[model samples]
Target: MQYLKRYLLICIAFICILLGIIGIVLPLLPTTPFFILALACFARSSQRFHQQLLNSPYVGPILADWEADKRIDKQRKKQIMLMIVCSFAVSIWLLQAQFHLQLLLIVIMFILLFCIKRIAEK
Candidate 1:
């Protein structure tokens, strides 16, 4: 049973790492969260995997900053916010026929903005 759980965790971490890699190139996927998810999973399952994740060039610094300071660079935050807002803009534009959907999108946008604000800037 213990071995099964460990293997499952390894599988999950590998999947998350793959998703993180994909997210790097796909604008809609958001890489950092997947990388962080993999980090968390590997931390519980394998020490070596955790160390390798921390040493990764692209997502390592983000994971380190998030773990140590719970913060991200201000410029990164701005870029994220801009991308989110633009995506919302495109969605809202496309859903113009549905007033309720527009309203829902507006609410979602505000909620996302609030959540983003809660993340400390480095």
Candidate 2:
């Protein structure tokens, strides 16, 4: 049972990591949350995998900041916010015929901004 649980967690962790990678290209999705989830799973299931994740160049620093203080640095926060705005703006503009979709995108963008704002700065 314990082994099965560990295997399940490891699988989930890898899936989350893949989503995090995809989130890098898809602005509507967020990367940090997925990466963080993966990190949490790895921490619980496998120390080696957790350390390997921490050693990743692209994701390590962000996770390290989150782990240390549960907050992102001001600069990184600004960058994320900027990316969200730009990507959402493009998406909203591209879907001109769909007013409802545009509105939904706007709402999602604002919600994302709000969530980012609420995260305490490190």
Candidate 3:
């Protein structure tokens, strides 16, 4: 039903926003994608929630810019790259003797870098 769909979207949005907040302290979980997901869900479910997300201090401008331009600022792209590197470094260092896992992590890092390269820089 329409109400059920709206409720699910709002729930998903809230969960994604929570994950985005947690990603602040946890390096492995990239925050922007989750925040972007939340924004989309909120937009479909509730204008007020969408506006609140748009007004957030740290993420607001980034979300607005992304929605309007589908582009990320140069500094943010660099930061994302740095975060990716640090996350992989930490994961590899912490998972000692897991050769296969380490290799997979390296692959993931490369993929992340490749994706990062594709994002338009402002």
Candidate 4:
């Protein structure tokens, strides 16, 4: 059972890391969330994998800072929020759904923006 759990975590971590790499080239796909997941899973399942992730140039510093401080810097928070908003806006505009769907998306985006703003402020 323990081995199974570890195997699953490693698999998930690998998949997340792959997705994170893909997200680097795809503007719409998020990078941080997947890297974070990979970090977490690797931390639990494999020290070597965790070290490799921590040594990664693109995401290593952010992960290190997050692990050490449990918080993202203000500048990074703002940048992440901007990216999220822009991506959401693009998604909303591209959708050919009904008015209700647009309204719902706007509301959800607003709520998410508000939450991100609050987190960034803190």
Computed on alpha carbons, the lDDT of every model, listed in order, comes to: 0.82, 0.93, 0.90, 0.80
- What candidate 2 gets wrong by more than 4 Å, as runs, is none
lDDT value for model 1: 0.82
lDDT of 4 by residue, 1-122 (tens): 99999999999999998998887765455678789899999999999999999998879998888767667788888887787777777767877666777677777767756765665232
TM-score of model 2 (CA atoms): 0.95
Candidate 4: which pairs clash? none
Give per-residue CA lDDT, model 1, range 26-45, as digits (tens). Answer: 54455677888888888889
Best by lDDT: 2
Better of 1 and 2 by lDDT: 2
> What's every prediction's RMSD, in angstroms?
2.9, 0.9, 1.5, 2.9
**Clash totals for all candidate models:** 0, 0, 0, 0
- Poorest 10 consecutive residues of model 4 by lDDT? 113-122
Candidates in order, TM-scores: namely 0.72, 0.95, 0.89, 0.76
Q: Which residue ranges in model 3 land beyond 4 Å of their true spot?
A: none
For candidate 4, give the lDDT. Answer: 0.80
